[model samples]
Target: MRILLIEDDDLIVESLTKALTEQHYVVDVATDGETGWELAEAFVYNLILLDVVLPKLDGFSLCQRLRSQGNQTPILLLTAQDTSTSKVTGLDAGADDYLAKPFDMSEWLARMRALLRRGGASLPPLLEWRNLQLDPSTCEVTCNGQPLHLPPKEYELLELLG
Candidate 1:
């Protein structure tokens, strides 16, 4: 799965990027809201991780704009603001989920997985076609219990067909 991470904090970006990569997710990063917006408009990502306080554009405005444009990509807000109002505002702005700063990585991952599953035609984590099975989270494929090595495009095609 591909994810767009919009965050200015280098430390947080580094940590999240490493963790997401380790989980077999392809991550595209933007340091500011404007850059993030441009990237999001140009590419297709399974999910977006946006920070509330951003340079040029705030996460709320960005989310609203994307929704206005009919973008249905799942958005998860990552911010330091933990107040009830902030959560409500984020949700109102079209965020699928919200995670406060200093959050547990496990919780973040779980929320992301749920959003991705819910956002994309309700696709399950595992896809199956006859004897073939695909595990999106692990990027693994097996045919009749035998592992199969496939190129990226082939893998994607199989996923689409499945």
Candidate 2:
């Protein structure tokens, strides 16, 4: 999955970036809301992890502005404020989910997976083109139901072609 992480805390940013990269996700990090917003607007991210408090602009305004611009990318608000009002504000600003700070990595992974699945990330196991069938989940391919056993690059090319 491609994710945009908007955070100001250096430690949190570094840790989350490492974790997500280790899980084979493509991550783009921005330290402030301004840079984050620019990247978010320029790219089609599968998910966005936005911090509530940020330099230049806050997450709520960023989320709202993005929504206003017709960007419907799933946004998960990451905030230290764990209150009813804060959660409601995030939701009202168009966040798909809210995760309080000090959250477990496992929970974040699960939440991201859930959101992606809801967006149809779990499509059919196979994508067929001509005699080629690609299974993205496993990075495997088969031709006419027989395993092709392609190298990673070959499989990726076939997937791109298909």
Candidate 3:
């Protein structure tokens, strides 16, 4: 699976990248909300891990904007704000799930798995055209039996136009 992590904290980014990659996921990192927005617009991902308080733009605005643009990618808010209001705001802004900071990693993983299962039902299993194949399950594409190491945006565009 491919996930976009939009967090500014170096420590959290490092840890999450390590954990997700260890699980055979492709982890793409964005340090700020604006960059996150750009990446989200450019790439295709199974999920987005968003942080609330961020530079350039806040998570709520970004989430709302993405939803307004009809981006249905699952977003999980991983922020320190654990209050009822914050949780409500996050959910209201279009996040599929919310995880308070200092959370149990196992629980987080479980939530991700649940979200993926729900989303998996909505998307096509795979896409293919001639010698090209796009596998959404693995976030991989191959042409003529050779892996095509295209960037996310290019890969997404190829999937759309193939």
**In model 1, what is the error at residue 46, expressed in angstroms?**
0.6
Tell me the RMSD of model 3 versus the true structure.
6.0
RMSD of each: 4.0, 4.0, 6.0
List, residue by residue over 118-142, the lDDT tens digit for candidate 2: 6675343568888877765445578
Per-residue lDDT for 18-134 in model 1, tens only?
898766677999999999989999998889999999999999999999999998999999999999999999999999899999999999999988888686563447988889999
Window of ten residues with lowest summed lDDT in model 3: 153-162
Candidate 3 lDDT, tens digit per residue, 18-82? Answer: 88765556789999999999999999988999999999999999999999999999999999999
List where candidate 3 sits over 4 angstroms from the true fold: 122-162
Q: On a 0 to 100 scale, what is the lDDT of residue 110 in model 2?
A: 89
> Which model scores highest in TM-score?
1
Which candidate number has the best lDDT? Answer: 1
Local distance difference test values of all predictions, in order: 0.89, 0.84, 0.88
Error of 2 at 79 (Å): 0.9
Question: What C-alpha lDDT, on a 0 to 100 scale, does residue 48 get in candidate 2?
Answer: 94
